[model samples]
Structures are given as C-alpha cells and as structure tokens.
Target: MTTKKPVVVELYDEIVFPDPSEAFLSRVQGHPAVNLPRLPAGVTLPPPIPVEDASKRRKGDTKDHSLTQWFTNFSEADELLQLAAARQRVQAHIAKLRRQISLIDGQQQQFKSTPEQ
Candidate 1:
C-alpha cells in the first residue's frame, strides 16, 4: 500500500490593507468643509503693514516673556511651598477670627448671667 500526502492550503493570500496616505487623501477630498476658511462675517482683515525698522520695534521680552514663562520651569516643590505659605496665612486668619467669636460669645453669656446693678 502507498502512503498519501495531504496538500497544505494558504488562507488570506489575497487580503490587502488600504494605504494610509490614500485613505487620508480620500477622506479630506470627500469632506466639503476641509479646505474652507472659517471666519465670522463683517470681520475684515487689515492690510499687511511692512515693518521697515527693527530698531523702533518695541520688544516684548521683558513683559510677555516673563508672563508666558512664569510657570514653565516651576516644579512640584515650588508649588508646595506656595501652597504651604497660603495655607498658613489662611489658617492664622481663621484662628484669629475664631478666637474673636469665642470672646464675643463669652461676653454675651456673662452679660446675660449678671444681675442688673
């Protein structure tokens, strides 16, 4: 008797994925609002002014740079320091107010308990 060998079959040989670039292009092309510039009505853009002098231009380094970069380099330690300082000040104020209220309540109770002189 002759031994028979079974043939192996491959599946998904014809399966192909679509190109990402082509898919993106197709999506943008299909969308109607992809290329339109969105702006409110009655807002006319001013004409471009040529900057002829660099010497006369006001520098924003001292003002804008400080504001924009104020917290850029901040660390958790710095935040905790500020938070602790604020908490201490607030807690002190609250303690003072509470003491004042307690004194007022004590005075009121004393006035009520004292007989008319």
Candidate 2:
C-alpha cells in the first residue's frame, strides 16, 4: 500500500502588515496652547534664554517667558498653566487689596472733612 502525504493548508494569508514607508506617523501630543514646530534634521537648537533671580523681582511681577511656547509633555504644560493661573490669581488679589485700601482711605477722608464738635 502507498503512503499518503497530508496537504498543508495556510489560513489568514490575506492579513498583511502595512509597509513602513506607507505607515502614518502619530502626532506628538503636547500642551493645547503650545505650537509644536517641527525642526528639520541636523538643525541645531537655539540657546537658552537667561532667567533673572526671583528674589530681586517685585511682588506679583510677571515675566514674558514664564509660559514658554514649546513644551515636551502634558505634565509640563499643566505645570505652566498652573503657574499662569496662580499669577492671575495673585494679580486679582492685589487689585482687590488696593481697592480695599482706597475704600479705607475714602472713609478716613470723610471723617476728616466732617466738622468736630
């Protein structure tokens, strides 16, 4: 009797991986407010801007570069956003304090203008 050979069968041959060249690149996620400008290959990064000492700055003073245009990740963006919000809150609180002082000054002037018995 002749020995019979079993035929090998292949399943899911239609499944194929996408070509690397044709593949879509995922966008780098960052802060919503930040603009992510792509730099060309071999391009050198710009020099870092010098930051001033915090102790010398006046209270509630804001710096232009406090919120940077570029960020690496979500956490960095969140941190910068929090800093901005805190700065705004400080400014608002200062304004409120100034308004209170003005009101107190006005009341003092009213007392001064009144004739004493």
Every model's TM-score:
0.39, 0.36
Per-residue accuracy of model 1 over 1-117 as CA lDDT, tens digit each? 445877779876543234458877788667987685655798555532344543354553233222333335544556778999999999999999999999999999999999998
Candidate 1 backbone clash number: 0
Which residue segments of model 2 deviate by more than 4 Å? 1-74
User: What TM-score would you give candidate 1 relative to the actual structure?
Assistant: 0.39
lDDT of 1: 0.65
The lowest-lDDT stretch of 10 consecutive residues in candidate 1 is 61-70
lDDT of 2 by residue, 56-101 (tens): 5555434333443454333545667899999999999999999999
Score residue 22 of candidate 2 by CA lDDT: 27
Best candidate, lDDT: 1
Candidate 1, after superposition: displacement of residue 51 in Å? 42
